[model samples]
Target: MKQLLVFIRKEFYHVFRDRRTLLILFGLPTAQILLFGFALSSEVKNINLAVVDFAHDQATQHIIGKLQASRYFHLQQAPLSYAAMETAFRQGKIKAALVFPANFSADLGHTGRGQLQIVADGSDPNTASTITTYLTAIVGDYQRQLNQAAGALPFQIVPETRLLYNPEMNGSLNFIPGVLALVLMIVCTTLTSVSIVREKERGTMEVLLVSPFRPLLVLIAKAVPYLVLSLLDFTLILLLSVFVLDVEIRGSVMLLYGVSTVFIVACLSLGLLISNVTASQQVAMLVSMMGMMLPTLLFTGFMFPLENLPGPLRLIPNLLPSHWYYLVVKAVMLKGLGFGAVWRETLILLGMSVALLGISLRNFNIRLA
Candidate 1:
């Protein structure tokens, strides 16, 4: 028993001595708690809402003011015309829009009834559903308040809620894009990193480097097979999504594949960067899983509304390639958006792939020396 106790104490000392071990033991759990606590919220806040009040009447202005003051929404600069509102939605500027027809207040005053059109972006069904419900509740509350005051007539504000992009609100639509991002990243990054590390472990990597071929060419050659394999994986996922899940690729199939190729290249480049930095398979897996995988899972907006996250945490998703890829997939697959809608996201992914590949090649040069 005494010997066992001494051995346990020695093991504890060894654990504390290794910074990486200490981090895995303590830091990882703490970080998970902080991130999950903030990021996994169901209650969506800070919704960007656009209001078009054609009535310019007291009742319409009052409701707009209430929406502006509500914790749930940030009333965007009111779009002047229907054309402007459509433009905002297409550009992904606002999550929901409210439109009050002309003579809105007069109809409410005389007939004790009113009509309001509420338009929600339904690409993310959950957020769209929640915002519509919340907005309806707010409008209902105003009607209730009027009825309670001065023994007024029963006032009714009927909201005609229309869900754009996904009228049926099929939950599958939301997860398909997210799954593509998650699966491709995990498979490509883990497989590529593990494969390269395996080469290093088996001593073949040094053999390949010693050849007369350029180091960059060798690196690309090593990555090429995995790149092709990852694309095949993507193809399989797309087929499953289309047939099994019945989620149609609304945009051009060529455009979808084109954007996905960019994303896959970015993920492959990331894996190369990981392989170059880590000497062992264990370290590479840890970095790939804990470092790359966690960010991809958490920062990708499909898992939750980005608005729920705090200010500093919000910036994390912007830095992640998976997040951008997820957005591009949603725009193309769900919204039927053309390349014009997704050019910015595609450009960013292309830039990241180039930068990561460049760095990995530089690291290989240093290793060769």
Candidate 2:
């Protein structure tokens, strides 16, 4: 018990003494939470829109008034020609353009139909899709109101929408869990790798090796402190996501924590393997940045859709622990799934932890011999 306490104390000292590691462990999580919550949002707001109104009628003016008042779109340009609309979009001044055909109100009044073309910049598919949906709903609602005022039209199509799981479509609920996984990877893996290599650089690892403690014991001693710290950081992140960001965990909290624990173990083991392979602190830092951090960020479907990535790039996430963690987090947080829903991911994380531990042990023994 005394030896364990001493080991833990030493580990804490190492962790706290380095300002960079401490900041990455605690500061980075909060930064990422705020960034993804506010700055990096998929929700569209204040989008600039252009109008090419060939039909300068009272009805068209009324429709444009409703659009400008709705607050989702801003009427940035009222172009006289399609060429002007094209120029505005090409200059990145507007996201969408609405064109009202000539004699729009005359056609609607006589034949009960009119043509309105909406041309969107398809370069950003997400923004375009959202804008399209919003426009459709607004137009449909306006048409229904007009019909009701005109004594009930013969044609009526009622559309009922039911959003599954995330009824509110809160992006934070999806984003927070992914950010948690990413921050934990940086904290556990990069920091651990650097800490272990620091020991080698300072000539402390050799001294510890000469002691009676086994290599496995030393490894555990180093990792256990980080595990505790990670759990504490996890709780902080969870609380911030819930109370501050208004993100909810639909599944059992205990189950989420259990899966998170498995993921942290896997990440820490990978860090340990990295520590064993690298000889110096600089090499460890470089390897952690290049080998683990880049792959974890790019391939984990955090910022970009995995399906949109090329085949070769898609295969890269298969080898990353963050990819598995993202799946588990999405299941628990967004889908309200339990252990049964994410058993495969949990097993993959466990298998990865075991494999990394085995490799680290083999390397440690070889170095000892």
Candidate 3:
């Protein structure tokens, strides 16, 4: 027990003594949380909307008034023509354009119907979809109110939307889990890889291997401390996400921890594999950044939606552990799903961990051989 405590203490000393490792362990979580919470959000607010009202009538004025009243859109410019609207959008001054035809009021008054063209920049499809929905809802509500006043329709088509899990649909709630997975991967994998390769670079790995302690035991001792630290980091992130950002975990906390544990193991095993294969710390760092970090960021649906990606790019997420982790996070945090709901993802992570461990162990044996 004393020896184990001493080993753990040594691990802590090594971690604290190196400023870079300490920064990666502690600083990264805080920075990532702040970044995701503030900078990275899917919810669009105050979107610049250009309006071209050729109608020049009360009906068009009313519609524009309603649009400006809604907080989702900010009326930026009143362009005269479609060309001007297109130019404004191209220049990135506006995200969407509202065009009211010249005969809007006359047609609506005489024929009970008119057309309003909404041209949205489809470059960011998600934002475009959201803005379109908001505009439709507002216009529909206004139409319904007008119909009610005229007693033309007995029944109304009220939008009955039941948002599953996350009723508020806060993007932070959706992002927190992914960020947690990413931060843990970066810390655990990078730390383990660097630590192992540092020993190799310092010519101490051979000395340690030749010592009385078993190699596997030494590996376990080195890794166990990091496992504990990763858990600590996970807990801190979870707490901050919930209390600070108002992100809730609708599913069981135990389930989240369980899934996260498997993912962490897989990530750490990958680091071990890299550490065993690479001869220097620089190589390990480069390999991890190129092989793990880039793939995880691009394919895991962290910054971009998987659905928006092309077919070939979509398949890439299947190869990454972070993709599965992101799904688990979304299910638990946003969908409020139980174990049964995320069983497939959990199994995938488990399988990945087992496979990585097996590969890492084989490589360790090869190194010994």
Best model number under lDDT: 3
**Every model's Cα RMSD, please?**
15.9, 3.6, 4.0
After superposition, which runs of candidate 3 have C-alpha atoms over 4 Å from their true positions? 52-58, 77-93, 101-103, 117-133, 153-167, 298-320, 365-369
The sequence of per-residue lDDT tens digits that candidate 1 reaches over residues 1-369 is 453444345434544576764454344433433343345445677899999989998888778877877877988999999999999999999999999999888898888778989999999999999999878877876776677774655443434343422234455567667767876786668767876787788887787677554556655665665566567666766776667556778998898788888888888888888988888989988888898878887889887788999989999898888999999989998899999999999899888877877777677643544
Tens digits of per-residue lDDT, candidate 2, 189-230, equal: 888888888888898888888987767778888899989989
> For each candidate, what is the lDDT?
0.75, 0.81, 0.82
Candidate 3 backbone overlaps, count? 0
- Decoy 2 TM-score against native: 0.83
- By lDDT rank, best first, the candidates go 3, 2, 1
Which is the winner by lDDT between candidate 2 and candidate 3?
3
Q: Give the per-residue lDDT of model 3 (tens digit) for 1-369.
A: 566667778889999899998898889998889888977776778889988999998777878898888777899869888888888989999999888898988887787777888889899999899888777776666676677777865664556332321226676766787788788888878888888889888988887777776677667777888888898899989888888888767888988888888998998898898898898999998888788887887788867788999778778888788899989978987789998888998898899999998888777742444
Sliding window of 10 residues with minimal summed lDDT for model 1 = 158-167
Inter-residue clash pairs, candidate 1: none
Model 3, 192: alpha-carbon shift in Å? 0.4
Instruction: Candidate 3: give the clashing pairs.
Output: none
- Candidate 3 scores a C-alpha RMSD against the true structure in Å of 4.0
